[model samples]
Target: MSEQVPQLQQDPQQILEHVFGYSAFRGPQQAVIDTLVSGRDALVLMPTGGGKSLCYQIPALARPGCGVVISPLIALMQDQVEALQAAGVRAAFLNSSLPFNEVQDIETALLHGELDLLYLAPERLLQPRTLELLTRIELSLFAIDEAHCVSQWGHDFRADYLHLNCLHEQFPRVPRIALTATADQRTRGEIAQRLDLEQAEHFVSSFDRPNIQYRIAQKNNPRRQLLQFLRDEQQDNAGIVYCLSRAKVENTAEWLCQQGFNALPYHAGLPAQMRAEHQRRFLREDGVIVVATIAFGMGIDKPDVRFVAHLDLPKSVEAYYQETGRAGRDGEASTALLLYGLEDVVKLGQMAAMSEGSEEHKRQERNRLNAMLGLCEITSCRRQALLRYFAEEQLEPCGNCDTCLEPPQTWDGTQAATKLLSCVYRTGQRFGASHVIDVLRGSENEKVLKFNHHQVSTYGIGRELSANEWKGVVRQLVVRGYLEVEGEFQGLRLTEACRPLLRGEESIELRKLPPKARGERGESRRDSVAADIDPADEPLWQALRGCRKQLADDNGVPPYVIFHDATLRGMVQAKPQTPDQLLAVSGVGDSKLERFGEAFLTVLRESQAAPVEE
Candidate 1:
């Protein structure tokens, strides 16, 4: 049991300060906590790092019995439990990772009312034995984390989540809180309907992660672009690079390794043990990068990840938001770089069309993909567009995205669009962008001449524009729904939405292609995880990190579990030499102060006594 467990009747705010070491609630946390404490229900829609856990963790401590958390992230359950235990909360998780004897011991503890909180995988919790065991004990409340998985339309949907309403059916008297970081209005309704939380109060926090600079570039030699971004900006920082396929993940990881980086590959296709080891290294070590597909990063709680780069396009805005949200989780400045191209769009569109879903499902997915592409091509603020997709409105430009920092120039491409659409139509609309572009650029290539496209009326009519420029126009047309990709060859075809532009009834303003390489834009932004540190305090910072590493290694946990980088930064700024002063630092709760205060205080005192290196 953790030494810092407060009395059963302690105030929620007291638990927040004494156990978690925070002064106040962020956003709707306090209100949600109050709702749960009063034995009501809540449906929380906060952002990734908006302190969702405290809403239930604090309420559980204040209420009568133990709080049971149902999560789908089996890989992360142990780390979550360990972090809570380190904070002096009597937290334990029942998962396949534990031996039978340990599971029996934990069950014994729960039956004896010795645990304040318990974490369980949803599938495990649904078992007959687990249900019977739960009926034998008092439960403070039920918390459903990652509740968006209940919605089939959600990107990370899990079939097991469909039956979570059983919690509501079986434990009607227990207050329930279902929480998720990413869900639009439609997905939220689906979650409520699926989880039987229709009457639960909904708390929707702002989805803006202003600290993350959103940047998307035209994919030209993506590996080189990714390497440049790493070498120039995010050197020696913990980050994640997402690829669309397992092979790409592996190849990218190996290539990065050859380029002298600490990169590892993770995908569902990898051996389970290998994936687990890579995930462990990423969580436990510093300056390590994980090159993975979408299979990774659902419940990752690593706080210091500095960047998330996507070598290919995400399928939807929700997925893009969720994946990018993993970065800058500690509220420090971070970067989300995406290298995208027309081929990515074609591939994703074909995938959506060929999926096994019903027509309506496929249509919804196609619309979602188009919206994501719109976000990429838009000349306006990316943050505003992203928020707007989730039904949250941001009135002002964020000045943090690629467009806001170096706004792209827009040109009147209505004539150019008409010419390309005309070319596609004249070329039989059965050819892909490259062939259409060749016909437009007057290339007299073998394919064009063989197909007699050189004799078409619109052939060489668009000679004024370069091949790359024509490709951009085609991509924008496809993104705006004026065009669609179909068939095995991925040929371009016109949509009804293009009628106005084709008839010269509408003028289209297209973003001018940006420079081949965006230069030093991120350099001006103080986005590094350690950007707040002072040069003169370097020695103290190193000593604090060293102390944290040693403590974590001795305790067999990640270094952040000992003390987050934010807490160390707090320590450095406060320079606390006494227990009370150290406790004054944010994230330093009574339990952590008691366990770690002396060692850090000694370091502070010794730093004061050491002579200046200069």
Candidate 2:
């Protein structure tokens, strides 16, 4: 039997004071930290602001020696290293971005035991020479950031991650921790299996970011709609605008910049140096709008982004959430604007159908995309619908979204739903939403004329609603359980839930599409950086972040390893006076309390005295 590890008996607050100079832990950080510090493996799924990094960073520092962090993106490694250096920790990275001398210098530091933490790409870690070198060092632990990449089903799969099982084979004694912001059930299982973490403890945070208001607009006059969104709701805050094509990325950025906002374009096609320069400028300069494909946002560490606007529909809600999560990482209020058309949905559906995954994966992707479409088209609380997609039950509506702001007028759609369903069944359910809508509206359009749908009994009965209104009704019907997408036919079909409506056994209430004028209740807020954040408080956040950075640097861990924003927020809020008091905060274990705890306590005391003057 495995020995039961003796529990460390230090106060969390004191550990926080000594190691991270914090007085508290936020959300599940303490629980997660405890699991890791106990020398066990853990798989963490937390939101962007949920402080996932601290779960491993602090524990790495509390442990005996250097920790290795396997990160996918070289740019991400550099950003992490810089942040750690700012906090006064010994940190270095090995990636292709570095020159030979720099890489050798970092390796020498690792060999000489001069570094506490080292960030490496999976490819580098798997290198024979690198593995040979690591055999000489006394490693403390291993951490994998963005663990979802290990699964091919994931949005950002990296083939190199599949080789990480070598870490367990070579360093059997070292503990392992894998962290990611997003993963569905299947992806989670795949991660555990692929990374050889089957026995690891699992920590899943609620996948809801309530502070972000969700909105989806029909793709009509998209540029105009985006401009209106910027003018009405954005409040001149900086945001990322995602496009599907590089050409669109360039055009949109240039147009926005011409309109007097500081906008820039970034895409894979651009020169690497130019992309890096622009990204740095956006990070350092506030209120700069970035228009790019998905290339610009991932691995971006900017914290004060107020919004994430997409001019095109993302492939899935997972992509949407991960992209949007970039906004408001500072834990402030933000918005997620999605503009898509029928064409966009069709295109995505085709792509999903074409993917070389399992039938179940394709079905799930379609369902997720449909859910996203429902979120966009609904005249209800976007936040409520989004939470529901994650299987969360929310009765009370969020008052911030467009629907909640302008309440939708619902009517009894029992008769209308019956008519729509009947038409689908009679027509063999072989067509998509548009054809169904056309059939109902009695349009003499080409498809309708060809199908001779103007002669059907149900034809012309829906003239009371416009084509757009009919589209909304059909979409809403599908969401409300009266209909389902027929996978084989690639069309809409009635579900068992529709039986009651058709048989007059039940009544369905349908909300009328709000007037275009009504939907225009709020103008885009300014498209500039946020003004409400106290620039003065930034220094304190930076100082606390600095302490976090140093701890991570010294331990060769991610900054979040030291303490999460919530814990740091607690310290900034409570500034404890002693190590014993620090131990009271969450995320500080006895081992952490005994190791390097005094150093953090000193920083906290010193920080409190100077108070990080702005």
TM-score of each model, in listed order: 0.96, 0.76
lDDT of 1: 0.90
lDDT of 2 at 457: 79
Model 2 per-residue lDDT tens digits across residues 78-150:
7777655544457788988889998888888888888767999999999999999989996767999999889
Q: State the number of backbone clashes in model 1.
A: 0
Residues 1-614, model 1: lDDT tens digits: 12223335789889989998989888889899888887888999989888888889999999888999998887668778889999999999998988999999999999999999999999999899999999999888999999998888879988988988988889888889999999999999999999999999999999999989999987878898998889888778889999999999999999999999999999999998999999999999989999999999998999888899999999999999999999988898889999899999999988888899999999999889988988899888999999999998998999999888888999999999999999889998899999999988888889999999999998888889888888889888988888888889989899899898888798999989876775565683323555678987888998999999988888888999989889999988989989999998999999999888898899999988899877
Off by over 4 Å in 1: 1-8, 524-527
Scored by CA lDDT, what does every candidate get?
0.90, 0.75
Q: What TM-score number comes out for model 1? A: 0.96
